[model samples]
Target: MTGAVLAERTEMVDGAPSALAALRRGEPVVLTHARERHLVIAAERVTGRTMALLVRYSSGFACVAIEGERLAALDIPLMEADDAGREAFAVSVDAGAGLTTGISALERARTVRALAHPSTTPADLVRPGHVVPVQVRPGGVLERPAPPEAAADLCRLAGLVPAAVFAAIPESVSEPLPTALADLTTVRVEDVVRHRERAEPLVHPAAVAPLATRRGLLTQHTYVDVRGGTEHLAVVAGAVADADAVPVRVHDECLAGDLLGSVRCRCAGDLAAALDAVATAGNGVVVYVRGGAACGGQPTGVAVPADRDRVAAHVLRDLGVRSVVLLTDDHGHAGRLSAFGMPVVACAPLTPAGQCDLRAGAVE
Candidate 1:
């Protein structure tokens, strides 16, 4: 990979720490989603410079992101409906009496401070005023992949109160984030998602049962999630816990290839081959995760959304699999997965058969 590609990947997977560091230092970060990007900073970090940045760059009126409970604490209700489809925006507000005409950057900054403060109550603000208040979902971006939730999530991750100030950046997707501001951090919604998975107990166990597959009778474990996700499940091919280091494949779903055998990708072949490898070992794991995580041969690596691996790491710990020989070619995963509590993937590829080029590594 080139230097730029490496830097971009770092921003995607491990950028949260840097973003949090920026927040701690009272700096701003650029936030990106699908086709949109925003300038975000912890509400507590709303300095004069930050406010100027928001005021100058925002395509619309800047908003403060807070939890639903915070919105209610201020006696604020939903804005009936969002015409723009930007959900969770409560009514606009000013910082009550003695507050400036809320439109000014300074005034909006004060209102944001009040919104983020713990002692601020309903009497502290007036409704239908200048500053827009957005109620982020309780589960942050994992529940709703919106800029408000993502902005708020950064605050939570940084150990501050879960409140943030964000405004749309009028830049296009192809444009580089304008470097006009100092201490400007940059991150993605996917970064927030990946950050949460890495830092929180993102997946929860609900049930397990025997699943009859073409390979054999695999034990399937299901999970409950805030996303109402059914796609995150695990299939244990054999008694992996009994082994010192079991062969494991953290597979992401690619329906086009896995089901219809679409030659667009080798997902079907790799999954089948992984299952076969585990079955043959009679002591391995094949974790099914990610709706369409992009990997190669099967896109299961650090460059991909290792949300699947993070999910798998938790599942493996839950399943009592102490160590693992990760079945993947992407050697980069070992370091990342280790942080999620699994030992680093061993350095060997378990190539039992079927051209599934799975790497084998020693787990120690």
Candidate 2:
């Protein structure tokens, strides 16, 4: 695309916040990638009414996008054993109870909810069922930044489970992003990147120290942000700016879990795992934000506020890190890193223990 065309397209998108607001309010949104568009709905919010809309206008096979680790937690495996396929399709499933058949719109909606629920387990789902769950390819939108990844990213931004129900619209890529699809908000992937890139993250470097720890000699960065007025830390292991697909972990503060070693959440374990990965990687970073807001008041540290995520992104950029492969502790969090031009090439689970139950802080 020409520069003028790119600029015009950028103007058409309002980006994450707008889409996030609508999703939080239980509304669907149009997510665009390249020229193709898809109708996306939060998995938890999918209803009979919305299912009908997707079925009529979208690709008939509506799929729910989720983190691959969550799939393992529920005893679901990728459709392909080797997981070499690009589609990222996993074993299909349906709600295990309260439904006679899985083909109905309402039934499929229930299946989606089961997938998104934190308390849901393998027994709560039946394999080879009506609803298909597609794993979000790590680094989330930062990795691919396509419709599927964007759907999951938007859901996460709304402080919901990263699972999303999305289906391709019949619309052609040459068409303009719709301002109204039954009044659903529209967000273009590139537009979100531009929106984030419009300004630098609001943070000022305060201090740096060479910290000697068990992992090795790691550098620590402290930043004071005027907006949040919080002291955020970025611990570095060796040189990263010159690397590609460098490992990065954006850890939001969770005192109760990280400090107290509370079994109530996996915050502590995830943090330790991240530290281990960075130390071993020899070229990585762990960005820590203070006072993280849990998703829906849940104790999980998975959801980092969009602004804080942006701060982490800028910190990485300042460190000279180019593209990255996210070293995620739990859930599917890529944040708005890709938005600021710091691409997340992939997401790797540091250890199998961290991969066990994706929702460590979830309650029934």
Candidate 3:
């Protein structure tokens, strides 16, 4: 009847019967710990219905609460006591009540736990092979089953399986099964090829363009012209070579902050500054390109054909401009520009005061 006694009883039962099973027997167990009794019920029995139960303690204590089928299945009481007795039972119920429900509970708990803490599932930890369930969405509803090879390949990549590494294979051309199954360790050759394929088009030098908007200002925009078999630099040229003579502020699209306003980087600020600079130049160009990475909180882009720095270099080289002032929030872009024999000025340290002065110069 006391909380302590209930806990001792629950612990005493080696190979303890499930609360759900006990509820089916019409003999619901009263789990006691520290002179308190917590009611246990079969979740399945309460399915599609709500039930009211009384929680009691040895110190002549009691509380009443309502519970639904789903909550019962989760073994979590909807309402608990404000006292120590209820608090103690809550811990035991969370740990002991749901193990018998099979994979569903484990999966649900995995998701719930992941939201609060970084955790890996048994699947994440085991080497089940390179194969994983390929779904249209990651952690989304599965529409079609993954191909055997794709599953195996995923397993290998996850270290769930083992196999030989081979040359990278393109996801578009390669058979998903064989390509994925070919290797189960490191990044799959197919994955590497797929990454390269995705990245090549975005990073290729010829895919970029530079334009001068006004007498002293410029803007550059990058694009993927999939319409023609050849990559077109039309957008950049059109913006820069507009019959105006304004200075240009060549800006790369920052997928992270420009679109999402990620606080980690000053992508959006740089973009706004570029546009204002070009406008002040009275006739300038602003070349804008898509961010070269995926959309994420991190200061990096997703897999793409060309990186923003590479596109900037291509635009600068085409203009034949010597010692152009390159502005970017990230210093990483500087190293990238160096490879193209371009000079880079990391605009990171420029304060708002400095930016204001630069904008003034653009107008002058």
Candidate 4:
């Protein structure tokens, strides 16, 4: 059935305030227009369970909306808890004129799916002042149409302000959601944006334990950003090779490749190469950044430039190293460390064996 049939009963719609409260309490709300239906929910309220329900109810993944100003106030812990949540959290926007409004039907459909499965954050659908990322699975681009109008209508009918819209499968044929998310509803994206909280601080690092990998014995160090209330890790291969030019890599965390051995990205290989390079050199530091959870689950790669420079530098300094020979693929890090007077080396790609494809003793 199409959303038109499901949303035909316009009289049953609830007030905006109650709908907004339902969203805060983790409910899925169905909003309809002439022929469109939207399953709207707040980004802050998204959980793995709710995500499952949203996807199941809509017969596809859910989309997310966030106000511009509340971007920084996003719940990092919540974003990192689920893979799709991370993808949704990564979409960015400026505000106002920059907001995305107009789009071809095909383009909107593709954008919604892209937002769900991003390598980095997708940038095509620019919605000024708000960041809306949808939880769509890839490869069914045309399966669901974008609900731009329905999102706006729902927000307007519910008396809620708009931020970004996450397009989901129409619930025309779906049954009422279970009790957990029966009230999946929303409030003014504006109110949530206005009442958003600041990120917690990252205080200091604490030593974990010595972990022995195939390469060698390594000491693990964990630092909690108490203010940000997140944790970061540093894997030390061996004694410092040189204080002036210590080999170091600021690696971003990847759930798929690093842990699950997925080949979608080279993160796993990159990480192994970094560790091996450091091990071969018999010294150096590999700072594995929990960039996602630590910084509110933004997209890895370009979206988050691994702003762990200060943390990496701190680790080196604490190890009695004054400077570093930075190892990385991202030019952003290369530039940041170079400005700080550290020698930088843009990392070469790794061979299939997870070894650096470089001439003997070359990182430049």
Candidate 5:
């Protein structure tokens, strides 16, 4: 392409309508910073195809970022404790003119405070969340801003509303960013959340069979979120129909512990215990959230706690469960479920001595 054509395309991308148009169509735009190339997509529009494309292009890491205003709109609670008891979703931003490449507690608290009130100084303009580390064997090279100026620039140049930034590096050099600028793929925020019309999950029912250890039958059903492209598994043992206060274990997916028998965590053992406990009770369910594994051996990335909880609740309601006994600790899970009037019993995994405690604080 001639410089004239390239300049025209740049002008189109730099135009406000250009960015909004790409985002509305669910496409990502190329963003260059310090000669490092990155793909900037709207956070709300992330989908399976977009993720696949990112995986194909990324060098290693990708993170979803949001502006301070958007973070405030999420209504996340302010930090209730010091650094020792900081919350998982709590993120920090630089309120003053300073460097913030790494996550700092003081910065996080200040960011929270700043968001709650008017800023004494202008923030550098971004915060990050839900980082997914991508590994590309071969592909186009891609990179994102250390402080998120690149994403902000893309949003500004494209005239797209800047709520959240989904930034990733593509790996291959064979295909550079589109010169046309308007033909990028984009999706709506509803696509990522699977809200309302897109909330229905694709269900796959597996065969039921008897288990020797539990002395009962087990049936597996997989629920795949069409919007997020993540799968959650449900294991039903015995009968669960019209079962009130069913014994339920919302186990996080553990690849190393559950499969490789890693001793660093009790995930594998706890999973088994939950199954035996449910079988002994003669009726219960185990909703295994795919993102829970502590070790990396699985492709499923971590799900935001809030989004995961909501999806799990939907699965339970569909299974005819009204109330449940949560098998693990994570008060956030209990608190969220409780709001829906679901009575939850936070229990610890059985000890090696064959004894267990129910009144424990946040079991692993």
Candidate 6:
């Protein structure tokens, strides 16, 4: 094994001469410290080609492991002399030595200590007279003036001096103000009031509607009564009605895995199979139930175990969707609809391949 040890300011660069020479010869290196060790495995060990350097940090310091061919391209310096080089060496040593703690933890501790002894409120990152955009209910971003009043309010919220607040304001508003007013303590009540007045008219409302009727989708606004409010709900149908049989799929909204096709979850595959099944029939409706339940008193956006399944049954029954096929990865969904009078089919362990075949009647 060949490695360097680093802690605090001092670092040791020496190692076994044979091992060090082996490393220079492009052989693998094993780093050890504090009873922990890590292997810098050569890519040739895994694959026939000499491509990458794979550093497998110990489990305690697993967070810092870097893989792939990028590491092999770096120029490995024989020694460290300057502060930057020393710091780089320290990082590698600490990472290889399995130092479980991160430098961020020390910085956070220092910040906490400083905040504990604070004599003044924190500085505001944003200032008044700046035109910050507000996202109104429906759709677009509304850029409005950060009047003195709003600035003062923001400063107060951020625990910053009002003058500091003014200075931080967008250049357009701050440039027009007198130099004296730019001082953190010199902001006037009238200035804030005037700024607020100029800002009041910029807020707007918006909503979202479906682009058009199509397979497995519907759309509507969430809140209709509030003025200047804009929030739209995109409803996807779970199952569509058919003359011979109704095909349905219960889908949960997975922002990352479904929309992004992240392999971490099966949401995207299941949704695609369901949509494909309904679309092929050319008559079924996919009643896209919102992931969470509509029940009052429940935490917002929490999907109750069987809420969507029940909703699906209700919608299907109302629409005269007989011979319905229920699709879902959640076993709880099947339990919820079991008591209903209609026949329902569930696709558990709902893999995309499995769902595709099931929906196509290739599997029972």
Q: What are the lDDT scores of the predictions, listed in order? A: 0.72, 0.74, 0.32, 0.47, 0.48, 0.32
Q: How far in Å is the alpha carbon of 284 misplaced in model 5?
A: 0.8
lDDT of 5: 0.48
RMSD of each: 9.7, 15.8, 23.4, 21.0, 20.6, 26.9
What is candidate 1's TM-score against the reference?
0.62
lDDT (Cα, tens digit) per residue for candidate 5, span 1-364: 2323322322322223444566556566555433455565654454446544544565534444434344445443233332222112334333444535423333333332343243343344344422421211110011221324334333433444442334445445435444443355432221122222123333333334444553567777677654455678878877676565577877777676688965545567777888887777777888777743343333344435554565676667667675666655555566555433344544443435332111212133
Query: Best lDDT goes to which candidate?
Result: 2
TM-score of each: 0.62, 0.54, 0.28, 0.37, 0.39, 0.29
Runs with alpha carbons beyond 4 Å of true place in candidate 1:
1-13, 81-86, 172-177, 202-275, 281-284, 288-313, 316-364
Model 2: how far residue 153 lies from native, Å: 1.2
Q: For residues 17-131, what per-residue lDDT tens digits would candidate 1 score against the true structure? A: 7889888777878888877878887997787677887778667578888988878778988887643346777889888867766777787888888888888889888888877
Ranked candidates (TM-score, high to low): 1, 2, 5, 4, 6, 3
Clashing pairs in 2: 241-320, 241-321
TM-score attained by model 5: 0.39
Cα misplacement distance, residue 324 of candidate 3 (Å): 1.6
Cα displacement (angstroms), candidate 1, residue 167, comes to 0.3
Off by over 4 Å in 3: 1-266, 282-286, 295-306, 345-364
Off by over 4 Å in 4: 1-203, 293-302, 340-364
The worst-scoring run of ten residues by lDDT in candidate 3 lies at: 134-143
**For residues 138-249, could you state the per-residue lDDT of candidate 4 as single tens digits?**
2111112234323433333344444324445464654564555454553332222112211112337676689898987888888775547567788877766355556787
lDDT of 6 by residue, 1-364 (tens): 0111112101223233333233334343333222323332211122111111221112222111111121122212212332311111211211112223413333222221222222313231111111111111111111121222232232222333211101122223323444422221222222232233233322122343553445434533232212233221323333333432455565544555456645544456666666666555544445544544322222233545454454455545545555444554444455445423334443333343543211111212
Stretches of candidate 6 exceeding 4 Å from the true structure: 1-244, 291-303, 328-332, 340-342, 345-364
Cα error, residue 60 of model 4, in Å, equals: 61
Which digits, one per residue and each the tens of the lDDT, describe model 3 over residues 1-364?
Answer: 2323322322333212232233334332333222222332222222111112211111212111111222233333323442322211221121122333312323323322221122323323222211111111121101111222222222223332211111122223332333323221222222322222223343334434344544333333344433243332322222333232223344444555668866555557766666655455443334455433433344333444234455554554444433333343334444444333334433332325322112111221
